[model samples]
Target: MNHDGHAKNSRTAYTHLLWWFLFAQGGVIAAILVPIHVLVQGILGPLGIVRVVDRHYDTWIRIVGNPIVKLYLLVLIAVPFFHFAHRLRYLLVDLGVPAARSVPAQVIFYGGAVVITAVTIWVLLTTVPISFG
Candidate 1:
């Protein structure tokens, strides 16, 4: 619509959309899951106030060894990585790093999150048993 009757292809718009989507989903997932994890695993169980049944070490191992539990743990641990990355990326940008849509910044931050997520998956699958069978 400028003069050649064409729309400008915004390179960063779709990329930003993806990051924003991850940021929002990560925020929601973390908010819902993290507090529950902290309360059950850290506060309530340790205090002996709620008496978490799987609080024992063996039981904890058995519980986490379940496939569903592994998936849940993966989601819990991985999604938050993106949330933190997005937050940190924006924090730097907000602090005047001129990285509002910098590709390097996005690559670094998002790449860290991806690496951490892959490590988490590998560790879970290799170290944590699926079942004694």
Candidate 2:
């Protein structure tokens, strides 16, 4: 009965709510954290403008091997990834791509996010610290 002629879309409210929640949380976290991350990691640390713990490979390795830091890094990378996927999906729809709302589009966008998140976790898990013994 809806505009798609698909009987009001069988997708439940909770799924929509989940995506919206991730999108909103991702946006806020990205806006607050991404800029600082870029400034510190991308610019200052590499350029030697600031001496951060991550400036040295040894220190960086030690820091990243910590579970807490790994979790933080996952949040830093994964949250905005979902946010971007949702935003891009809607952007395509708004740009008159009628197929953007289709099941394939959902699979492509959200599935991509899921894949990337899994890869990030795998990489983080594989980061074994080198013992100085």
Q: Say which candidate scores most in TM-score.
A: 2
**TM-score of model 1 (CA atoms):** 0.77
User: Highest lDDT: which candidate?
Assistant: 2
Clashing pairs in 1: none
Residue 64 alpha-carbon offset, candidate 1, angstroms: 0.8
Model 1 stretches astray by more than 4 angstroms: 1-17, 99-101
Tens-place lDDT per residue, model 1, 10-123, is 334676687678778889999988998798878998898997756777777887788988898898898888889988888888898886559888899999999999999998
The estimated TM-scores of all candidates read 0.77, 0.82
Indicate the residue-level lDDT of 9 in model 1. Answer: 52
Q: Which segments of candidate 2 are over 4 A away from where they belong?
A: 1-12, 129-133
Backbone clashes, each candidate: 0, 0
lDDT score of residue 71 within candidate 1: 91
Worst 10-residue lDDT window for candidate 2 reads: 124-133
RMSD, model 1, all Cα superposed? 3.8
Q: Residue 37 in candidate 2 has what lDDT? A: 83
